[model samples]
Target: MSYDKDDKRTHLELIQNVVTRMASNSFAIKGWTITLVAALMALSAASGTAKLFFFIAYVPLLAFWILDGYFLSLEKIYRKIYDYVAKDKITNEEYFSLNMTLYISRYNQIENNKYSGFKHVVDACITKTIFPFYIGLTVLVSVVFTLAL
Candidate 1:
């Protein structure tokens, strides 16, 4: 775990990298949401009809958001694992596999931070709002919207 000569800059850099990655992900999803919302709104205005299908696209997107949040929580678990290795609770073998998986476990350029605290806000805000929104929207579109069609 702990490396010799671990400078503050390195930790800060890691945090910055994680933030950048997350910002990029958010940008992509939000960008799509805006585009979709615009299209739906425009269609509603033109046809004088509102369709819920516009929001349906966000369902899987929110699922992905929540899944990423789960991974961020795993980062905290990794800290505990790192501590175990540091304290001799786990040996070098355990650490080696973890180190190896770091690079292999990427999900479409999203690296496994294994220590970032991104999950804190995601759990609090995303679960309460975004997740339920996705679910409710999906159900609405699937049942009620389909009936409209």
Candidate 2:
């Protein structure tokens, strides 16, 4: 298929937009997790119910951690799409195709079954960027709570 150079550029730009949005969403989730946890901790300390609020805080923390990991995985997938598109690894038929399943299947085939869907999200959760921050926060909160008891 004969494609316009401009069209390819526009399609790549669209994919890039999705990637950027995923990254932004991840950042926002992290911010909210920290803010909510801190607020809950402060309230607990002030209310003399550190045990209850500290336990409650874990719920949001774990929820946000999972959410953040999900977004990060999406970002990784879009990034792979962008790389494929930029390198012309994808055929002309797939040009401007934002369908992720097509790319994911292709990736799985290329990687020889190394790409399990849920495993990707779990991997994102343990990445250096995501794991350290959340785990550190959890540890800090646990220590403070323990001392408060």
Candidate 3:
């Protein structure tokens, strides 16, 4: 399937848009995580059950951490797709195909790579951009809980 220059450009734009949205979603998830954690902390302090509420807060923190990692992985996947589209290396059959699952296995097959399969989400969780913030929050909660007890 021969694609015109315009067709390829449009396809690339579509992939780029997905990349952008994934990044935006990741950012939003982070924001929500902070907000929820803060609210839960405040509730715990006010309720005099700091231990219980602090523990409960961990639920959202871990949940959001995983969710954020998932979004980050998707962003990475779309980015790889954008690179392929930009290079015009996509096969004739895959031309303009936005299905990302087609590339996930290929990405995983890269030798000795840490970011593969479910590990991709785990890797995303520990990236410089992600790990510190969540770890810091956890430490803060632990310190406060200890002080309260």
TM-scores, all candidates, are 0.38, 0.92, 0.89
**Top TM-score: which candidate number?**
2
lDDT of 3 by residue, 14-60 (tens): 88888899888988988898899889888877887888887898999
lDDT of each: 0.47, 0.90, 0.83
Q: Estimate, for each residue in 36-94, the C-alpha lDDT of model 2 and write its tens digit.
A: 99999899889978889979989999999999999999999999999988877787668
Q: How close to the true structure is residue 85 of candidate 3, measured as C-alpha lDDT?
A: 73
> Candidate 3: worst 10 consecutive residues by lDDT?
105-114
Candidate 2 TM-score over all chains jointly:
0.92
Q: What is the C-alpha lDDT profile of model 1 across 1-149, one tens digit per residue?
A: 54332533344345445545654665465456446544554564456354554454455556555654554444434454444444443333443344424432332134344433454546633555356654665464456445555
Taking all chains together, the TM-score of candidate 1 against the true structure is 0.38
Give the poorly placed runs of model 2, Cα more than 4 Å off: none
State how far residue 147 of model 3 sits from its true place (Å): 2.1
Q: Please say which candidate is ahead in TM-score: 1 or 3.
A: 3
